[model samples]
Target: MLKNNKSDYMNWIILIGVFVLLLEVLFFNRGVIFSLFISAGMIYLGRKKSAKKKGKILFWGGIVFLCASVFNMMTFKFFLLAILLHFFIKYTSSKKNPNRVSPVLVEPEITKQEETVVVSKPLLDNTIFGQQKTPTGVYEWDDVNIQAGIGDTVIDLSYTVFPKGETVIFIRNIIGNIHILVPYDIEVSVHHSVIAGTTTMLDFHQPKIFNKAFHLKTPGYDHAEQKVKIFTSLVVGNLEVGRI
Candidate 1:
């Protein structure tokens, strides 16, 4: 209840700020919108928990400044500084989602294991968190249709699995790090291309091959095929490969 009251008060403050911005735009039309909107946007963006959102907010801000410039209202010099400020702020935004610093009152998941074939939203959202259980030891972990964030997530998993025939890990855009462990005797093929994480080869009983950031550690050239791919240049965070 105390937290709820705090949230309500903050909202009221934001509302007042928005009202002030509107009044500034009305009364001071020269460069008022630029200053007013930027101020309002900065405060709003400051409270946002997503890095992706900060970009959008900044992007819209650029559009506003660009529009102002095109109309011969604000100088391009002012526009550039305003845009650069927003771009720079995005770099520091999300090491984690702010609202999720602690477990909130989100409703619990009640799905059965059979129904829990995991599907992920943006991964950067409220997805890869809240629970982790011991893997079922039947060697069924490989080829498991696991869905990980394709975007920047506050927290993620590092896993290792070996499949009898084939294996796959579906990654969208994991922000931080990804470490995979495989059986030392299996021949594995990994297919992934992403700029967010650095993939490194590790020494094991198996032979390891790397192409640029693509790495595959194999006992020998079994050519027994299995693969995973992650899209590159994702609007997310970083990734690093390591052993579990």
Candidate 2:
């Protein structure tokens, strides 16, 4: 249920992938069909992740499909798609397109007075309690303190409230995809230097930090900069760097 643990998640993917491959080689000899089923199953299971996450399922699925496809060019579509999409993600991810964008998260600063006064606005919490399924979740952030307990709790921080001036986000145990959204026209500075995950800056450079992870981005040179400073550190998790 808790989807933030990176090691566990990757292990699941790998385990399932290898299992699927073995099944393909032994039982279901439909070429990419095995990979496709495994990937699709994972995606369906992780339907709650995100748009990019869904893509990742397919993406990694494609990676597994490669081995099986080698023997059968009959399913050229799967092979071509896997190679093309994998490279496409790699190319676009590495090349750094200034025009591409990602979701925006508004981390609000809670003054003492504001904290005392409970606003009636909706918050992005991880769970919809009492419901059968949490198709939509909200966030509520008093602060992302480095408490050992809350480390790998994949927060739906889409609606988190962050302090002004400077802040960095951290992940402890789980491998999660931190989805951050910046407002259009807000000159917010961004940085993501964390271990275990890649950083991508949708419209800017990677965050300056000590051994940062993956995928971090902010407004590129084409856009105006903000006065407020924002720093994010995902000690563990995928930093899906982008601005859209």
Candidate 3:
């Protein structure tokens, strides 16, 4: 049954791909295929003859042509339409459900008093495009857990003192590197995963890793009282953990 389902899924994908190609040829730009091939040839030739002035022109021209071809394709039109349709549906849904009931509203008999509380800012704030580093001077120790869109994360354990038990540092990045500096006294355990990158944890070095997970640890990590446990994942990047 699973094999049949898989075959059906593949068939559907092939059919959809063929249909899209047919649409591109018949209804949309017919020369897009040729344009892409030409662009690729131009780019290859340009790289081969990179020292000459004509190579520079070919490189830039190929880039421009590729962009033009992509933008004029049926797929791009579908992408734009999908974006517009998504926004339109979202706006309509928001307008219709303006007074959506919360979980608290469902429990009518339970009355609770509202209390004011102070919220402290986290040490490693989430960012899209910037480095997240530990403070240089003396600062309170906090468990680092942040999701970054595209940036390097640097955590230095030398500045702040760690509490007893396991100190966790969890980081998730779409496209960035993770570098952690740990003191020699502190035992460390790392669980790092990457889609396409490398890992350099202490003396261990994985030059080219793809879609793999690594579990590394100091010999004393299991029994150390003030040890740090790092969990990091990246879509396309590197991981490096070393002694400070």
Candidate 4:
């Protein structure tokens, strides 16, 4: 409840700021209103036509007009700085959390039966930045979570084994590219949320957008004995899933 209240308060503050800015633009800088209208029209046309190139053109043009209306470039610079600072602070804070769990590599355990042998692999929870590649070979894991902040991450599970029922992998990325390689035999499903990015699963492609959510699944995902479910959130990045 307290968190909700705080969020409401912040939203109100933002609304008030927008109201004041609107009043100022209408009274003190009427020329800006015209620029805004033009920008809006361009953006609308671009969206209607599904032309990303046109959208980019008008978006930057709108920013230029908005900056001119606001008097100087300092505000824009400050806004960008604030955004960077916010992400930096958020990243550092997450790393510093006392309850945060660190990832560890585990080897498979072997057990012998009367006439057979069995191997049980450990689950993996990895948080990585920059470029990384998953260990290659046959293995089994229960739950895998990956946090890739930047650069590229390649995960190949072509030869791995999954336990019966649902196995989950969670990924959070920012300004990075993730490529997941899965085998054809196992069922795979992906639930992804992207902001200003692209997601490609097999032959399906999701173009970059302001915000988009995608759910992709292979055949037999629902009733398959062995299934892999991947939940991913990406910001300003790309995610590609392919067969091995």
lDDT top scorer: 3
Off by over 4 Å in 2: 1-174, 204-210, 213-228
Question: For candidate 4, what is the lDDT?
Answer: 0.69
What order do candidates take by lDDT, descending? 3, 4, 2, 1
List TM-score per model, in order.
0.32, 0.29, 0.58, 0.53
lDDT of 1 by residue, 1-244 (tens): 9689757856765565566546545764556546544543443343233358775566456446645544543333444554576466555554443445666796759855654577643322223532223243432233333334322322212334443454444544333233444444444455555432244434422212122344454455455554332223221233343334
Indicate which candidate wins on TM-score: 3
- The deviation in Å at residue 128 for candidate 2 is 17
Candidate 2 on 42-125: residue-level lDDT in tens? 433343343576755754464455445555533344445555765787688667855568989978697455336666642223
Q: State how far residue 124 of model 1 sits from its true place (Å).
A: 16
Output the better candidate (3/4) by lDDT. Answer: 3
lDDT tens digits, residue span 10-86, model 4:
67655655666666666755566576556544433433343477765764565466446555433344455556765
lDDT by candidate, in order shown: 0.42, 0.44, 0.83, 0.69
Q: Backbone clashes per model, in order? A: 9, 42, 0, 0
Collision count of model 3: 0
The C-alpha stretches of model 1 lying farther than 4 A from their native spots are 1-139, 150-163, 203-219, 224-244
Reference-based TM-score, model 3: 0.58
TM-score rank order? 3, 4, 1, 2
Pick by TM-score: 1 or 3, better one: 3
Residue pairs with backbone overlap in model 4: none
- CA RMSD (A), model 3: 8.9
